[model samples]
Target: MRVLTSTLLVEAVTELSRGTRLVRAKEVLAWCDRNQVDCQGAGLKNQALWDADLEEAGGPHRLLKFKSGECKQSRVGWALIAHGAKAREAAAHLGWRELRWTGENWDWLGGEPPPPPRRPASREAPAQAAAVRG
Candidate 1:
């Protein structure tokens, strides 16, 4: 099985928030647990696992964005996606275009193109940069 990171799941939901789907919180929680996510301190405080939210939108009744911690956020977005929450609206809120789910894996549909490939320095740039900085 291709294990998914919590970040990926969150990003996927953010991407898929345009299809009017309502995903349950429990489903997301279950997926996180199965994927060995360390959510013990990842927020999600008192909300029930069964709570449903529109895939990617943000509101009190839906996927409310909470300050998980210093520069971190919760995976509540996954719950929203699993429940088939509104994808387009949610994607708008998340600044994504579309979402894609294959009943197991989720990903962005139409968003920023992937990052450029990394190329190893010819054993020169790194040393030169370091030397220049030093």
Candidate 2:
């Protein structure tokens, strides 16, 4: 059976709109079938897909599933959220706030946590540094 590698996962997510698009359970099943992956009932049996803490190479983001059962029974499917985005953000995006969200699972996609965005230094910093040096 084909394993769900980071590349396939990333491609699937990217092709599906990077989490902005809501994928159905059947579509996910089709992906597995097309890739020659084995499914456990209606869900994938791949460890990489089920592991909540799986680290893989891609971007500074995550690929997660909103699981309601042991499988992909839930209509809500997957999303790719920023690594630093809060659990609530994921929960909200997947519309699981009022549903069975306890088993939400995720994989650590992306290589390094991206460098923090740089902000311009304050106008007074150079003057202060020069005075201190003097």
Candidate 3:
């Protein structure tokens, strides 16, 4: 069983159209929520995953189904969101927001948290920096 890595998912998502990408992303969020511990039928033994995820590296879109009564991540050092540590959780931790957005170039999730986008220096701060430099 090949573990569906985020890298693979990202690549798949990149291949999809913006509208379709969001649809898949929404499914991912739903999958995570449904599989949450507090939710019913939430356990490795009872949980089910999408067939596409297991087969085609479905990424985000595609109808989901259980592959029997349980599922497991094929990759080593991997765990499901229900158990703890999931792709969605990792995405959130890396600063992904659930907005109705669709863009091929937009980053859905990054393996690591990215640096904050640069902002123009404020007037006072710029002056202070210049004084120090001079």
What lDDT does candidate 3 reach at residue 17? Answer: 24
lDDT of 3 at 6: 46
lDDT per model vs. reference: 0.40, 0.47, 0.33
TM-scores for all candidates: the values are: 0.25, 0.39, 0.21
Worst 10 residues of 3 by lDDT: 62-71
lDDT of 3 by residue, 1-134 (tens): 23333444333344432333232433443444543411112345322232223333334433211111111321111223232234335434543332111323222232233334357868899789899999
Model 3, residue pairs in steric clash:
none
Top candidate when judged by lDDT against the true structure? 2
Off by over 4 Å in 1: 1-6, 9-20, 42-134
Model 2 agreement with the true structure over 35-59: per-residue lDDT tens digits: 7754342454544553322333223
Q: Kindly provide the TM-score of model 2 when superposed on the true structure, using C-alpha atoms.
A: 0.39
lDDT of 1 by residue, 24-125 (tens): 344455655766643333346522221222222322323332211121232233335344335445534544334344344334454342333356769888
Q: In candidate 1, where is summed lDDT lowest over 10 consecutive residues?
A: 65-74
Q: Which candidate is the best by TM-score?
A: 2
State each candidate's clash count: 22, 1, 0
